[model samples]
Target: MQTIWAPWRITYILGEKEQGCFLCQKARQVEHDEENFVLCRKTHAFVLMNVYPYNNGHLMIAPYAHVSSLTELHHDQLEDMFRLAQLCESVLTLVMQPEGFNIGINLGKVAGAGVEDHLHLHIVPRWNGDTNYMTTIADTRIIPQQLEETCELLRSGFLLEQKER
Candidate 1:
């Protein structure tokens, strides 16, 4: 197996444990969409670009209320969460159409929920050979574009569409 280098993972090393709820913290902060990478905010849910994306335009639609279990969400929140996910796909198709996608939620710690306190639906854009030898053999992921660039592009489209409407 060839060794693959991914320098970006270092950004997550220090202070990761000290960090609290990312979704709540970002929503409370003073920043533009490009800074926060927030796409849309609904009554019960909101969409945001993944700070660490599996691909260039990866996104997550999450309920505002922090809950680990799928059954823990109020009916309206669950509906709005999936609805926002659909909207995310719609926007991604319009702006950054990939060949395919990976969408799901991991409910618990063992199930791979990085933030088990809050539920977020992941929308990962996929293409042929996306899961190549690097992931399986080398334990690395090669994402071509920077998260900030992707954030800027998505936020621009979202803001433009909002203004048009």
Candidate 2:
């Protein structure tokens, strides 16, 4: 039998899943900025690094409102989500230098929404040869960077964007 060790995933395996909406809680709680991995917070929406990511710079932009459906959001909230999504794209390009990206919104559980109770957009960075033996053969992904490093790297990009404005 082939054995692969992913010690980092042990924390996730043993950790307790929190009650309530994790995204909503993270949106309001700024106390644990780095712990929460929040890169940038806007009026109606915020950009945060995915604790569990498909790629290094994976991010999600969500509105502060608790509404799940896209139609339930106010016009400005929808606008903020899009604005932040665009910012996430630029940030990923600058920090990760990915060849491409996969950006989308999963509305319902049936539609692959991890947090179906809150609406958000997922931005997954991709590269030409990012896929390798680990993902293809071992059925696991190896993120080359830690979450903190990713957050800090993307945060710098966001800060640079702010300065340019």
Candidate 3:
């Protein structure tokens, strides 16, 4: 059997899970944006990198409201979320140059929603040959870049894009 060393995962495995919604916590803590990996914030929504990402430039666009369903959001919130999704795609494309993107929302826990209570859209950047045998054979996905480094790149990209707008 081949062993893969993922030393960082131990923090999540052994650390005590904080009470209350993590998304809400992150949303409220605007001062801690860098520590929380928040790339951009809009009037009604924000964009941040996925700590447990499926790919290198994976991002999530979420509203400030802590509603489980999209129906609960006002039209402005929904619009803001979608606009942030576009921003995520643009920033990722500029920084990572992905060939394509997979963008969608998982509504429930059974639907692959990691934070089901707060509806968010995922923007996963893809490239040719990004998926390898390790995914099917070992049931593991490899992310090439460090989360902090990716966050820095994406954050810079977002700033540059927004400034040009």
Please report, in order, the local distance difference test score of every candidate based on alpha carbons.
0.79, 0.87, 0.90
The regions of model 1 sitting more than 4 angstroms off are 1-10, 14-18, 30-33, 160-165
* Top candidate, metric TM-score: 3
| TM, every model | 0.83, 0.92, 0.96
Report model 1's TM-score to 2 decimal places: 0.83
- By TM-score: ranked, best first: 3, 2, 1
- Tell how far residue 142 is off in model 2, in angstroms: 1.5
- Model 2 agreement with the true structure over 56-84: per-residue lDDT tens digits: 89898889899889899998999889988
Tens-digit per-residue lDDT, 1-165, candidate 3: 778887768988998997998888889999999999988999899988889999998998889999999999999999999888878888889999999999999999999887779888889999999999999988899988889899888888998999988
Cα lDDT for residue 92, candidate 1: 78
Regions more than 4 Å wrong, model 3: none
Q: What are the per-model numbers of colliding residue pairs?
A: 0, 0, 0
Better of 1 and 3 by lDDT: 3
